[model samples]
Target: MSPGLTADDFDFHLPPELIAQHPPARRSDSRLLDAGSPPALIDRGFRDLPGLLRAGDLVVFNDTRVIPARLWGFKAAGEAGAALGGAVEVLVERVRADNRVWAHVRASKSPKPG
Candidate 1:
């Protein structure tokens, strides 16, 4: 580990072949590891999820789905060159209370607040 990092900086090594490239045959067939007291071993189906939780337990989920917001276009007659136009990336962080968005974008330069 580097001087600035501790155990938290450690990560496991996984080969590409070890990664799950596709969803399981059935969602319920996915793996789960119980790390709490009396650690139990169980293979459960995704459909069995509701039964595992007690009623009224608050659940938080990331409802944000993917968006194809990438834009690739050249600024005509601009000082910036074609190489700058090739640099394109866009990332939407979150939707704000006022319906505006927080985002991270990349190109040849930064963007001003809207």
Candidate 2:
């Protein structure tokens, strides 16, 4: 990566089929991307995680304990859940006294105000 590399430089287009609209029925069914080795992408399922750990390993889990302020999903236009066009992801930027939130929405277009 260049020192001057901006976010745009890392931009990418993901095929709609590859986007996950919902969580897997089983948490163990999820796949994990192992990037410990650089320059290579190792795809492994959660079942193989036991092999990746050592005895007496101290583990720290992430924010799944609480509901995320962020979400990712494609716009659903019909009953079949077809990709409306690309994906929509948002992150909570801040909260207001009115109990509303300001979020950073990302997609092909900015969403209209309610």
Candidate 3:
């Protein structure tokens, strides 16, 4: 069996200033990195993507509107309800009909099952 991956496996250094705060003036003008052939990094525009596709290739699209879904709170110790050491960060992935949510949580420790 393969080893499990942790957040550290995907961690890398990226300067905040290098991140794009907004989309390009024209969406199609966005940058695309063509790395299909290794060791050769070709920089292309988003408009060039259609021509690079082959038959039977699958493409997934995300069109959902972005929302403010991040939440922050402290993890409480069981029964006594005392606050834990650090704050817990929750990124809500989805909300169900029952009002429960699916989220990605980050905490100093794993929260006990309630």
Candidate 4:
């Protein structure tokens, strides 16, 4: 079996503007950032992925169920009808109460409750 990684060792920070809030022109047009254990990070495009991989390679996936907690809410601009729409992605960390939940939100800008 492989060695286990510590929880703290896997911490990563992603800028809000860099988040995928909007769909790309093409799925393959997305940019890929290499955050692996290399001395320097190499920025590459998705088109290069197919050429880099060879046969007989195995990829492992997490068995955890993914809950689509994607939410589209409008930010409270001056008035009600003039509000702007924004994408907010929330990852449930824990449940505090029946309606209260601890979560991490990623957005292009600060998201406000409608």
Candidate 5:
């Protein structure tokens, strides 16, 4: 099976303020969508789950639970004589084989290898 897809293949735009910073107040209150073959639609609360599933259907979940590995820091930019202040936001996605961390970083400038 082919594995890699370019970032352009899965592009999406979301407003910054719309992103949820934390989990829902109640897990069972979360909405679930059914995107199977026929694509059935339902708008019930999470408690209505057992009545929706069948015998052999698989239910996959993210087992790699999220840890608070994201950090917000700052960096200095511009030339040494004209160092401009900048903000940086970082999220540690996973640890790599070489003991380096794969991360998603947001800043005015791109990040560089240490």
Candidate 6:
């Protein structure tokens, strides 16, 4: 790791409108940002990736299968689960061997620990 490097170095302001809510109609139609060389940013298509590679170049592949792990529920306001505090969205990132999970949660109000 480089000395004095911090997580804040990777933080930036990405406007929410720039975020893609849905995938392209075709998988290969996705946009690719070429930042291999600094000070120059090239916009290319996914199909253009093949010609850019040379022999003996290392390629990393993410083969993790996607699953429907997102859950939608409401925060409980009462013990009997009769009242809804607010809507909650949970994206389960990983399941552990100890029957626990790591997730990204979004809600109007943060849930308190039980």
What local distance difference test score does each model get?
0.62, 0.78, 0.85, 0.71, 0.75, 0.88
Instruction: List candidate 3 segments past 4 Å from native.
Output: 1-15, 72-90, 102-114
Candidate closest to the true structure, highest lDDT: 6
Task: Encode model 6's per-residue lDDT on 1-114: one tens digit a residue.
Answer: 768979998799989998889999999999898888988989899899998899998989999999788999877775666677778899999989998999999988897764
Candidate 3 residues 7-108, lDDT tens each?
997699989997889999988889998988978989899899999899998989998998689999876654565555467899999989999999999988
Model 2 over residues 1-114: C-alpha lDDT tens digits? Answer: 658879997699979998889889999999888876777979899888888888997778786455478989765453466646457899987779999999888988765443
**Candidate 1 ranges with C-alpha deviation above 4 Å:** 1-10, 36-84, 97-99, 111-114
* Ranking according to lDDT, highest score first: 6, 3, 2, 5, 4, 1
Q: Which residues of candidate 2, in runs, are more than 4 Å off?
A: 1-9, 54-59, 64-114
**RMSD after CA superposition, every candidate:** 6.3, 10.4, 6.6, 10.4, 6.4, 5.0
Residue range 28-68, candidate 5, lDDT tens digits: 87665554445565556666777778999787877776678
**Which of candidates 1 and 3 is the stronger one according to lDDT?**
3
Candidate number with the higher TM-score (2 or 3): 3
List, in order, the clash count of every candidate structure: 2, 0, 0, 0, 0, 0
Scored against the true structure, residue 76 in model 2 reaches a CA lDDT of 49
Clash-forming residue pairs, model 3: none
The whole-model C-alpha lDDT of candidate 1 against the native structure comes to 0.62
Among these predictions, the greatest TM-score belongs to 6
Q: What's the distance in Å from true for residue 84, model 5?
A: 6.8
TM-score-best of 2 and 6: 6
